[model samples]
Target: MRKLLGACSLDVFARVDPLELIAPAPQGAALALYVNLLAESLHAAGRTARAQANGNSYGETVGELALGLAFELGARQGDWDAFCTALAAEHARAPAFWRQAGGEALLRKKVNDMFAVLRDKVDADNYQVACGRPCSPNRLYAYRMLDTAYGEIARLFAGWREHTAQVGAILGRPVDFSVPIEVRQLQSVAACRPEWIMRWSESLERFGGAPGPLHTKSKRFESLKNSPDKIADMLREIAEYEAISSNRDSGWLHDQDTAGAWIEDYWRVLDESAHGATPGPDLILEARTEELDAPMVEVAQAAPVADDDPLDAVRAQAVSLPPGFLSAARATQDPGSWAGRMLEDDSLPVRLAVYLKLLGAEDDCYPDAWRDPSTGALPNMQQLAALDAVSLPTLRKRRDAAIARLEAAPRTGG
Candidate 1:
């Protein structure tokens, strides 16, 4: 990430004020963290230019802003040109899709217009994660970012109550929970209760609905009795059909595979939050916080250590060991067993790098002494350097040299 953004630091971009559209109190740390994560992910994916283009912006990375704006503009899946054409066709020709009860239709239109921008800005997958439910284009206008459903269901219920007249229009009468199971589809995750569908049918006959399609009778409603979960799965399978929707439809407008998995694993993560997975091995070694400031090239100086350090004596002995021991360790360590080879290398630099690669450049060993206070995996780089009678930079170069040689050398008899 540093190499790519060598021209500018994230600190610069993060300081810029974001456009007024996003609310949520202009996140600082979370925004920066997300940006860094996104940058690292993109870079790993080999999109150097794109990753760097976002810089280190604090609030809302460019990708988030673009997706949200596109959504507001009614951008869907398709070739860019084709999608834009479809958005253009729908822009001004149609009336607002839904209207508020007491307020003028113009207010509804205004609300929808504002929402379009928000919709375009939100990442579809993230939107779902935040909401704990799916987002449909029809419902996008009503979504409020500050309200979370698990707790905000009250607000939603209140809104429905305030708009009771409109709610009444949809259901063909004023309604509440006691109104009956038929009016609102009682949600179940995996399966639809047939009894509920039967109850709904019975209610429809008595209550009636809006002018279109409701009065028509059909066996189609019978299939709904089977289960909502089954229905959901069917929807999931057909979810990809958004691509075939229109000239500008972006299929699902998010990574569906990821979102779906996330929803499924929500419970698992909750359950395992306390402990499902085993703890990772105590590496006893990790790069220090100073790694970003520290050079890959070693320096000669280190903090002083006691003269009688056993490590000092061990290094002196390792160098004088019968050459046969080094070769024997080498013969057994192969590229396929690179980790093992690292374990076996006699060169202090090579061994240190093996530790670095195993742990990471941020390792605690190098900055302090060879002793890893964290895990004690190996002597700290400082201690090792002291023993080698070499500068840290000299040691690092030799280590890197050894690594290059090891990687470049031909495969040997196993």
Candidate 2:
């Protein structure tokens, strides 16, 4: 009976635990409550032994770190108020004080300060590899939120006919319930495209007078736009995590032990040791590829550098370029003007990936002045994977596809 229960996904575990509200709240509230529920669910699944195995007394610290990161991420991305209000509306609860004017700044400061402590505690490298790359504590929080959102979407998909209005809302068009749900329409959420969420949010203005999660101003959902593949990947990762988490004998538990041992041997001695070892000639090596042997493709820039395309306006808003783009961004505060530029691109995911790369923070690369004051330069590949809520390889594929689109765009004024 216990073994049977363990097979259920975290979404299923939510049903067993009463703490999780039926309706959504702010991401922070929702995730914080869910993690507590997850900890308890671990016991029900008979895996508390592993959760409590380490005698470090860091009870639920991992869960706490995850929730903390979610709140900070919301603040950093300018998404806190919009999301909180939407959630409160969904749950029919009054918006929190923090959602009010003059409250957001206070909340932002608090969240930023909290992350200062939390980031130091988390071993980001270990967390990234284990949970999927680009894995910071904040990214982990985003993954769980997206996982939950996918589950919500899946639930709605199950009874498309019964809830035609909601289904129509999701489809971005009126639906005929008398007819069967289209194969492309009501398929599993894992198979569902991320654009559906964006459309649903866009379509909701007429129905609910509010945007859907994906359509909001938040960078939290930025990576998810038009990327069905990424959506599917995150859903699977959550499912896999739940499966391993519930089974004590699963290799994940063993990996945890291995990680803990590594910490004791290497991490602890790093500062004290005279010579700290680094990945070098012996441990790290570059791969040799046939491409290296191939002749390089040469392309000339014939377009006048002085003339900015109408599209540059959108690119300016969506990304932070090496050439100063701040002036254009500041000239227009209306995102709608530039948001449509994304539509001109073939793959929305690729466009969004490009934006993330150009706009996101960088480490040890660009001068601080060049980066976005609010969110730094683009993230590394591993971090990009986390932002997109996918594995490293998947992000690379999408990023490459986006680059191809850019390269293919015709240049004028030769």
Candidate 3:
């Protein structure tokens, strides 16, 4: 809702570069459009001025980051020279390109595309950053589509009384729109079955003189027709995400220091990816694997009574410690609880490997927990591998394997 620039000169943004500024990742066209939308808002100041001129009218100001993103996109998609030329030519109207035939249409399409992608990317990142889990761009798209389906179902439910016959056709029975809808009744995505969605779409033609969303040939929602379980999973994910998102401090995107810190995180993730770090397993595949391996759980538990369970003390220590990174250095006083926990995990090599993965080879926060008490600095992989008496490959393998198990374990609820 924050307007990026009220009335700034175009020269101020001449140096913007859209692609380079974006969070480093394999983003798609949607994200590009989102960045460009911010740029478009800058050029269309007359509209904002007019809205403000008309007293008591509501208006939305694009955020500054969004504006910078737009400039980057506009510089790429729209001709900066032509736009600047047109702006210089006349102080009154929109640029020549905007007034030219088909120019507005082209710009509009580009703008729409940018915003469409941006929204999903933001939502996806919101889920990942908060959850410390991974979510792909495709998953973001799925969440949006499922959210759309949920919305359509809610609309039909709200108007069920007035269109009882049409609704009855879809519901297979029912005369109860008069009664207030309860959240419990609409808890599961299965309640809004894919067949119901298809039926609702068919019923809409007679009741509202138009086919429903899925009834169309778009194929966007076509994938939802037969995947009720997938739909249910997404429904729950989005619901949980909604709660997490609501509680998050969106102010980070606005504050300079906080936003810079976020960008650092973004860069760190990209750096890790470049270095071949894994972002955990694919959810569906992992779930399937867990199911198949469920039978071995009891056997493993029963056979684990060895006198020397390698790293049992270490594992217990690591499990009991609090959150935060641990350095190699032992505190002169009491080393931090996190450090103690990591030591207790028993396998020093695995624990050190985890430190490398999480805190990176070096972090500012590592000052207190370095391997050498003299130098409060984290050691590199080569150092950890050397300490563990194994080759780099073996250390990495053990580290990743341990982290995978830790990630898969049930938490008290992160």
Q: What is the C-alpha local distance difference test score of each model?
A: 0.34, 0.41, 0.44
Q: Write the per-residue lDDT of candidate 2 for residues 232-288, one digit (tens) a residue.
A: 677666566555333412235435534433322332132123234343433221212
For model 3, residues 1-414, the per-residue Cα lDDT tens digits are 122232222222233332222324343443344333323444344245432343211122233233323333332433333333333444234344434676545434433454445445544555676555788766778676667767776666666666577667676566564653432366545355555555666687787797776566777767765675666666767777666544432333435444333333433333334457543433323333222211011111121123242222222222222111222222211223323322355455456566556544444333343333334445555444433433333455567666555444323211
Candidate 2: residue 21 lDDT (0-100): 35
Give every collision pair in model 2.
Answer: 134-382, 134-383, 201-212, 360-377, 360-378, 361-376, 361-377, 361-378
What's the lDDT for residue 400 in model 1? Answer: 50
| TM-score sort, best first | 3, 2, 1
lDDT, candidate 2, equals 0.41
Q: What TM-score does candidate 2 get on C-alpha atoms?
A: 0.30
Model 1 misses residue 283 by how many Å?
7.3
- Tell me the TM-score of model 1: 0.22
In lDDT terms, which candidate is top?
A: 3
lDDT of 1 by residue, 299-354 (tens): 34344433343333333232222222223222322332333333355554456544
The candidate with the higher lDDT, 2 or 3, is 3
lDDT of 2 at 32: 42
